[model samples]
Target: MSGPACVIRSDQAGICLFVRLTPKASRNAIGDVVANANGQMQLRVSVTAVPENGKANQVLIKLLAKAAKCPKSSVRIASGQTDRNKTLLIDGNPEELMAQISQLSGRTDT
Candidate 1:
């Protein structure tokens, strides 16, 4: 018997990021940076608004947009809308965007 099958594609445009969100904090700010066992950059953000009614999501989008220096409409929540870990679809070069994020977070991609 074969186990669950999966196919990995190489044409993917965006990178999937794992983020830890802290709602109801003082303001929207990026906190400690950690890397999972897989060496993925994990960031924590403290949002001022509660998680009710998609407020946290909006806050995250705004923060990311500001960080990316793009309009809010350009950054979109692709998945994990109801979960802390989210995947954002940014309409631009992933490599360049990742570089910008690395510069902002002071972390080098390894």
Candidate 2:
């Protein structure tokens, strides 16, 4: 079954992303795409890079940007830079954005 589209919330600063990151995995892939009962898509990523020297964070930004179909410069790690869970700022429609992510994750859109 296809996952539901993501919902983007506007903030005083910008759009926020609730990202769940997995460090030191075999590879980076969007997995377990689920929208919370509240309608927020909780994204899980498996990354091979260890969380050190901002390597994983940088990788996460690039990968997430690609998935969101936005320029890398458009995707910014707003908070939790030093933590596994991060909040991202991406400027775009949540549904269209999630569709791109599903494509990148090899999931067929419904």
Query: What tens digits encode model 2's per-residue C-alpha lDDT throughout 40-99?
Result: 565677788899998898888888887776888878887789876667887776566655
Most lDDT-accurate candidate: 2
RMSD, one per candidate, in order: 6.5, 5.0
What lDDT does model 2 reach? Answer: 0.69
lDDT of each: 0.65, 0.69
TM-score of each: 0.75, 0.68
lDDT of 1 at 101: 60
Instruction: Report lDDT (Cα) of residue 30, candidate 1.
Output: 70
User: What tens-digit string does per-residue lDDT give for candidate 1 at 1-110?
Assistant: 01111011111564344466778998788766665455554566679989899999899889977886777887777677888766577666666666666555565641
Residue-pair clashes per candidate, as listed?
Answer: 0, 0
Q: Which residue pairs show collisions in model 1? A: none
